[model samples]
Target: MSLRRTRSFALTVVVCAAVFTTACTVASPGSPSPVASTAPDAALQPFYDQKLSWGPCAPYATTATDRTAFANPKFDCARFEVPLDYTKPDGEKAEIAVLRQKALDQDARIGSLLMNPGGPGASGMSALTSIVSGGIGGGPLAQRFDLIGFDPRGVGASMPKIDCLTDAEQDAEREKTFADPSPAGVAAADANSELYAQRCTERVGTEVLANVGTRDVVRDMDILRAVLGDAKLNYLGYSYGTRIGSAYAEEFPGNVRALVLDGALDPQQSTIDRAVDQNAGFQGAFDAFAAWCSQQQTPCPLGQDPKQATTVFQALVRPLIDNPLPAGPGRVLSFADAQTGVSQALYVSAAYPILFQGIAGLATGDGETLLRLADFYYDRAPDGRYSNTIEAFTVISCVDEERITDRAQVAELNRRADEVAPFRSTGRGPVNSLDPCAFWPVPPTSKPHVPQVSGLPPTLVISVTGDPATPYEAGIDLAKALDGRLLTVEGNQHTAALQGDQCTDEIVTQYFIDLVLPPEGAQCKLA
Candidate 1:
């Protein structure tokens, strides 16, 4: 539901690759340049020169819909090996699970097109199936490049994954309302952060957690490029995926062939600023949703005055904190579930109907719908098992963002979240609650900076005016920082490009195929 996005209420909706070749021989197997080397201490020759054996995929789906999509035989999976710690390539290693959908027009195939959906924690393996179903890579785009999706280090289907809370524990944690800022509430929040941090450190140890950040993932990506026989990288990245692409551009500008970055995160914003900006984005999206709900539905659950939307919406769901609502047997909807479900629905305007119905049902004391929405957000299977997306998200965010250990700063961070996102905020007074990153096992690796990558070809950055996860200005800022062109989308969603927006998709397809840059300030609206 967030991008380390602090939801204040439910909180955990934090942010949340591959190669293919027809010859069946080694793809590229070339070593990285000195600047892009795995480490100065060790050369990455062994890791880059390895061959990947693509075979029938092991199941990556934990839910019914995903299972159906993944079962299609069109997919071939491979496990690519990379060092867990780049400094010690000869030491412990992690296996990145890569999935490939072979190009339909193999005769005209160009190369492999690697893709990532922004989750920092979301499963690239899971996203590929959805992308294929939605025809993102199917038509002309898929005909040329083998569409690839890989679960980054410690993500879905990857070896030595980051594991923390059990399914039952996760459920229990979600049931509790989290928007209080009182001293006792802050203390409890700190303790919970400590618990989560210690569990991660104990289960996967500090080294793996430390190495699972974006920098590490991009390194694995380069190795994948080498192993898959691609001399240059053709990539599509969304949301946090944009971060990876920009980082790659910064680290290895010469290796890029084509990159399409949509819903970009401003690389220069600090972690707290990024999270807070995202919170504001959500509130803005929520305002749009509330206004839309008023027009589209009878009696407008948000009431006649759209300006009063935040107060009305809060009145609707905030009571779930003390008195939970029944959803289905063995389940009840807490305030955490209500806000999470709403936030999830706000990501794409297409799902607004479901959101309206859920809120309407909530007004009628039926929370099954909203509860289901929250379930989808958490990836909770019917059997009550969960993927390690959230765990990996926290671990990656901790290492990627500059650490915040100061109590005063944390209090300010909480206050800012409440101020900017009162709809999602508890409306409680200023208070300090330690972020899970405060108790992280290791220091951060990446800091906020404007990426100034020279010698990079004209990259395309797409931003939507109403994007709630990675705001519109971030896109403008990122495009300027990277010296890339910006394609403006007039919409209310997370990402608009390459997701069946005909005009936007055509522009992206043209860019990827011919390396043609969109005109400055090119704009499209979702049809």
Candidate 2:
């Protein structure tokens, strides 16, 4: 089937250690400075004092393909020890899996360019390997610096990985039928969410779950910088990864050499605010897709009238909620499954065609295509095994945000979300009515606050005007908070660095290579 192509970045694609050593105490204009007593407790001196023993990356590979890829001699892997709680430096510890692809020209290497691809749960190691293996565009940074990627604690390949549900359990959860947005439905959804939290707490333990917030990850990044012997950190973060970069700057302003935060998340926004904004953004993207579909020849999958496209789309989805269509031998397209599939496709304009095909297939009584999209979104492999991303995302997100136990507030947010994205918000009432964190075993340790990193060099913040995940407004807020230059990409996509846009590419590359900052209010038109 033909896929609809668009200018948006693909969403369904691609998916930290510490030490205390003398390298940690080295104070330079670009080195992390000592914080006040109220700040996060510093890592134990031994953490900074330890040295990494880098060797073959083969043993750390998580998949057969990854193992084969790691066979390349140039890629080196290692594990570094980090304190579980910075406050308890000498207490329990965790190991972070690290991957490094050395610069091609060692003599001209600027330094290590650390990267995080977001998810707050996305495996940075997988992201880096994909780039090195040419799965994604690496741009000039690949040649200029040693590309460093490490799975944050409680993440892939890292010790104490968050494994809330077994493959079979997760499959059952994903395949469970979702009820419509009635009171009973909402109650059932809440019960399911609570059950998920209980399982995570029971299976993963509260100790590691309590410490997987952005602040902890930022601390880990600093320790990484120290161990890598880089006086300053050169970093790139995408999606939720932007939060890491922003938080890092807040915690260690002096340690930042050059940072690029694409698809920026606003640090000050509440969880409800973020959900509302994202819903609105996705609605806008859907509208764009509908409008585009209307321009197609007669019998367009969504029909000729763009105005009725949303109605048509809703008609196609509503039936799934009541009587899910058979997607395969044993799988069916549940309302929740269809929603997730559509949401993932909306991330990048390039996937529009595939979405169109999937929707068209669904319209014609074939649910297989759309079901496949949902599986991809959930990172479910063909064998029915699931990645730990969803579990990790939930755990880390719960610890980072203020817990919401008030039913009234949740109901209010759900109402507002429905208003923001009517068609897409249909059966989501229950999904949004309760906070996923409410059932978390541990209470939140952090709260939303604007990052206040001072004395940092000029940082570059990229915001795509029509981004569905991290909206442009959040990017504006992030840039203003960091006092960084904002490079706006006037297009529909999530994150715009190194995505084949000459203008965006030139601006970012110049910032990283020459330490140049774009003038205030710089904008790159979609090409």
Give TM-scores for every candidate, taking all chains together and pairing residue i with residue i: 0.91, 0.90
Residue-level error in angstroms, candidate 2, position 321: 1.0
Badly placed stretches (over 4 Å) of model 2 are 1-11, 14-43, 134-139, 177-183, 427-433
- Each prediction's whole-model lDDT (CA): 0.79, 0.76
* Candidate 1 lDDT by residue in tens digits, 464-525: 89888888999899989988888888888888766767888888887777677767667888
Question: What is the C-alpha lDDT profile of model 2 across 1-527, one tens digit per residue?
Answer: 00111111322343200000100011112323333212223446577666999999989876544667677888899988988988888889989989998877677778888988788677788777765654222457777888898898998888878999998887677666544567787788788888888888888888898898887898888888878877788898988888889988988887788899999888899887887888888889888888877776646687888788888898888877668888898888877777777777778776677778788988998888778877765567677877777778878888877787888777777777778877675644544346458888887877779886768777889999999888999989998999888888998777877666778877877777667777766889776
Q: Which window of ten consecutive residues has the lowest lDDT sum in model 1?
A: 17-26
* Residue 28 alpha-carbon offset, candidate 1, angstroms: 28
How far off is residue 133 in model 2, in Å? 3.9
The prediction achieving the highest lDDT against the true structure is 1
